[model samples]
Target: MTQQDVVSTGSTTEGRAPKGKALAATERIQAPVGGPGRGPMGGGMVGQKAMTFGPSARRLVAQMRPDRGKAVAVVVLGVISVALMSVGPRILGQATDLVFSGLFSRTIPAGVTQEQAVEGLRRQGDGNLADMLASMDHVVPGQGVDFDAVRNVLLVVLAIYAGAALLGWLQGFVLNTVVQNTVYRMREEVEAKINRLPLGYFDRSPRGELLSRVTNDIDNVSQTLQQTMSQLMTSLMTVVAVLAMMIWISPLLALIALVSVPISLLVTRAIMKRSQGMFVAQWRRTGRLNAHIEETFSGHSLVKVFGRQHEVEETFAEENDELYRVSFGAQFVSGLIMPSMMFVGNLNYVVIAVVGGLRVASGSLSLGEVQAFIQYTRQFTQPLTTVASMMNLLQSGVASAERVFELLDAEEEPVDAPATSAPAVRRGEVAFEDVAFRYDEDQPLIDDLSLVARPGQTVAIVGPTGAGKTTLVNLVMRFYDVDAGRITLDGVDITAMPRSALRGQIGMVLQDTWLFEGTIRDNIAYGRPDATEEQVLEAARATFVDRFVHSLPDGYDTVIDEEGSNLSAGERQLVTIARAFLTDPALLILDEATSSVDTRTELLLQHAMAALRTDRTSFVIAHRLSTIRDADLILVMEHGAIVEQGTHDQLLHAEGTYARLYNAQFAQAVA
Candidate 1:
């Protein structure tokens, strides 16, 4: 079930956003389709099953060329060391054979040269340690372990152990760094990409879902790499080493052990084919449930006002129910992988034991050889099962990789056309010429339109609800570039100006205010990080926000909770205004600046707007038109077109659309 974490998010946090809007970095990406090795960035980002110690295990191994020349040499030496370890077991086997043959027969095998024959004889005689080991010591317990052979084997084994240890350590060190750094880089890049996306992109996407992709999905990737990589690699190596040992010991026994391998793999493949999609569905459902709860809680005031608790709870329950079904199935299927492989592993072990026992009874193999063969069989079953489980993990990584790819594959905003050179505001003039735009083509919010606001003047736009006033403001900001005609700044077409450069000169106080987790001074100084203390206080003072802020024990350093929930609505707006004031842009947009405030706060904010607009070009969207009587230009917008434009006195005399709106609004207030 999608449990509600209704932890106290009191209205004391009203002045700010909830915890964090910066997307989570360590996200758990579910696998989608077509395997996990690719992202939209390209076809091969990383391997999903990189954990398996097989050939693919090397993919997880950092191919990082070490910075130090000595480290490189050491690393290479370590690999050679692990390869040499196999010789110790072979030597022991040969010594066993030599001892047995000496006790039973005197003659050496045909393969022995004259010098080798002498070494074998010494080993049989058990003379001095050196003489006995040196003889067949090179062969079996040959001549025995004298100082020389003992030292050599010890050195060789030490080197092999060192090499394996080095490989193990370096693999861990580099992989951790790479995964962590990659996540950090991805978070930064994703943030930048999200900023460039059109506002319309946010219309359909849930805030929580996007957050989870950046946070939970990437975390899943990191965790998988950390815990699984080593086990997977070791298991794979064991499988390969044991299989080779099995063949060398007895090809027939090796052949008998391998009969179930294909069956286990086929079953794994079939289960994966079914489970991959279910895993992805489970994650998707979780995102939906999270989004629903977030929206319901974030906007709880509206929900309760409308008595939507039952409706929202019912919706959440249904989504949670679906998620439960999907999760149970996905997890149930995931749980099957290891167990199924173990079952096959057991069968392989039983067969090998039965067949090898019969072969030994026939006198085809030595006691020691049979002992080693049975040891190899145990190695086969365990590592084979390990390899099988690795296969499952690898497949999961592939699935997760696919999901990560899907997220990375999400369409980023297209590059702006090459019209921008360097956008500068000399006179700070803006013009919209026959602009048309839409989030969806079939439902254009802004139709063919034209307007202009000269430098050093206030342009107030008034309209009934759903009349596209805010859409017009969005056009001026080039949030969604015009589908037709063009917009310009100071006679230069804005299409030729970099969006960042264009936006750098504009200050805004939006209806929806959000503040990061920081002190009040930091929040006000957000738009100007390097702003001096005096400057921040000045901005606050202009908005009259400092009056109440100073009342707190910490004064300007008072910390605010997310979304400024610790403050009143008016306080949030003033802080936002203070942030905009610090920008000191040539152009200003006050969108519903006073909509959520009480009368006293509205008057205070109105004074702040006037202060901030002294010598700048400005646009204000007025809900209460009475506040705009002093506007230099009054534009009455209807369906994205300006139907009336003039001063308050001129429009009143004209008795047009502006006059009708004025009468209706004034009459409503009187009633």
Candidate 2:
């Protein structure tokens, strides 16, 4: 199922075109279903297709097993409510017939006994009718009327309506609670699933798209449960009750009402067949438009700096126009359902009125029964109209549910097996033995790689872009396991150890620093959540973060905006370094950790790092040749293979790839 199948019902509202502010508000509201520019009913961008309804719907229902008793009670209440409500029109019709019968009957003198009147009719050879007439003694012709009987009928009808209303309210109340709790559980599960997913899964998926699933898709399911589920139950019950009442009143009129059903069905089927494709297009365009907006706005500054604002606007307009066109088509087509059904219903009404009038004249049917059947006919068609309108909501909801379930069912990171022994104490010694790996099997990235870092050794890796620098780091961190050979920590195979335990002993600081929206102290202590204020301050001082923190108005307690947007790039980098230092792991991985710092700060950070690396294994990846000049060992990599390995001075003297890179940087510095 495509998004086109999930058109919004709000678009069907008829009115003059919205202007100015109203137009903008409408666009925002409709952004998830339809928008400004769209294709014909059958046109829009195709998205991740929706799954078959059966499996997903069944799973969703099963998820509600915990609320099964409440759901059953709600359904039962709905049925009783509808049944009581359905009997109202028939009872009213009976009252109407009684009033008519008394109005036309022979005038009985005032104070005449009901038995006397019955005896007179009995003598006329209508003994059965006389007996029935005797019971309605107060309903005398001309001289008086049966006000008491009318009052009693009205009372009964009022009681049924009140009971139905009470039950209806109760059902809604219970259903609301069930739906809210069910959605809450689903959201919790999705959040947990996100934590269990592999990093590679995120690498291959767009962050915005994943966010759409978590927020938009799940919200759609919640809305459907809250709104559509109750309406669906009420509509179905109403249709059934209305039909039964119609038949009970008079089979002939019921048959006449039945004719409208097939006609209504045919009209609905034809319109739906044409509209479904357009609805799909509408939803698909909405998603695409939303994603484009999200992407563009997130990088708004970049677009402006690059002078590409016009291009972005043009792209947006194109998607927006497509959305409008498809939405218009889908809404227009679906709007046909109510009028057509009403037309069929009206025609059936005409037939029933004419036939029932002739029957009443022939004394075959009462005026009251015909009136009651007409009301039933109207009630029956109302549910059909409701169902028709609700189809879009139901389909959209299912589509959203399917997307959410797809994410929940996605492949997760492999779980570790039971460890044969407890993790060994580390001595800062790491080794990679003949490791081979590739992101894609057809293109090998690392081939027969072997390396070792002895205790307290510094291993600096220098390489050009696409030289597997990051991939190697990822392997060491076990973010991705090697396809062949083994990596060990202190001579023990790393794979045999649990990932959490292994990662706990390693610290990394990347070039792209990430900080959450919190105070500077909180960000510094992220790696060690339980760190004391003194420890946080020490780590901050070691990374030179304290220098800037003390200058801010609130010092360490200053609140940071999302992504640390409130701070400078260098400041963000320092916060991350502080986070790494607080952990004080046995092994450290620094990937251009000082790239964002100026010369003065870099010197201070380098001094701190040198002291921190004493008696600890450290791997530094950098493009700046001057940064690792004093390393104990330097590995020059080319095309995923190490071309040279030695101390910085030794590699510079040998004049291989490392020497050339160093000479070039040195030449540029002098120039």
Q: RMSDs, each prediction?
A: 9.5, 9.9
* Weakest lDDT window of 10 consecutive positions for candidate 1: 1-10
lDDT string, candidate 2, 1-671, tens digits: 11111110011101111111111111111222353222111112223555555676688878788999999999999999999989999998878877766763546655666677778878998765665565442355554446678789989999999999999999999999999989999999999888766545544343455677788878988998888888889989999999999888778878988988889889988887677666656655666677667767767777778888788788789989998998898778877887888888788888888987776655566667777877887788888878777766665676667767767776666686566564466687889999998765667778999999998899999988778776777777776778899998888787887777677778777776767788988877777778999999998887788888888989999999766877887787777777878888888888887877788778877876776677789999888878898888898888779999999888978988998888887896698
**Candidate 2: where is the Cα deviation over 4 Å?**
1-47, 53-59, 106-144, 273-280
lDDT of 1 by residue, 1-671 (tens): 00011101111111111111122233223322343211111111111221122332233233223323443543444334334433335444544554544443234454555455555556676434223223232343123224454556456656655666666666557555655665566566566666654544443356566665666665665666656655555556666666787788889988888887888779877777677667666656766666666667667877788787788778778989998998788777866877998888778778877876666545466545766676666666676566556554555454444445445545544565675555453677888888877644566566778888999889998887757777676666665567798888888787677666677777777776777789998888877778898998889998888889978879888899877878899888888888888878888887777888899888888898899888999998887878899999999887667888989899999999888888988896798
The per-residue C-alpha lDDT of model 2 at residue 193 equals: 86
Best by TM-score: 2
lDDT of 1: 0.64
TM-score of 2: 0.85
- Model 1: runs farther than 4 Å from truth? 1-170, 390-396, 416-425
Scored by CA lDDT, what does every candidate get?
0.64, 0.74
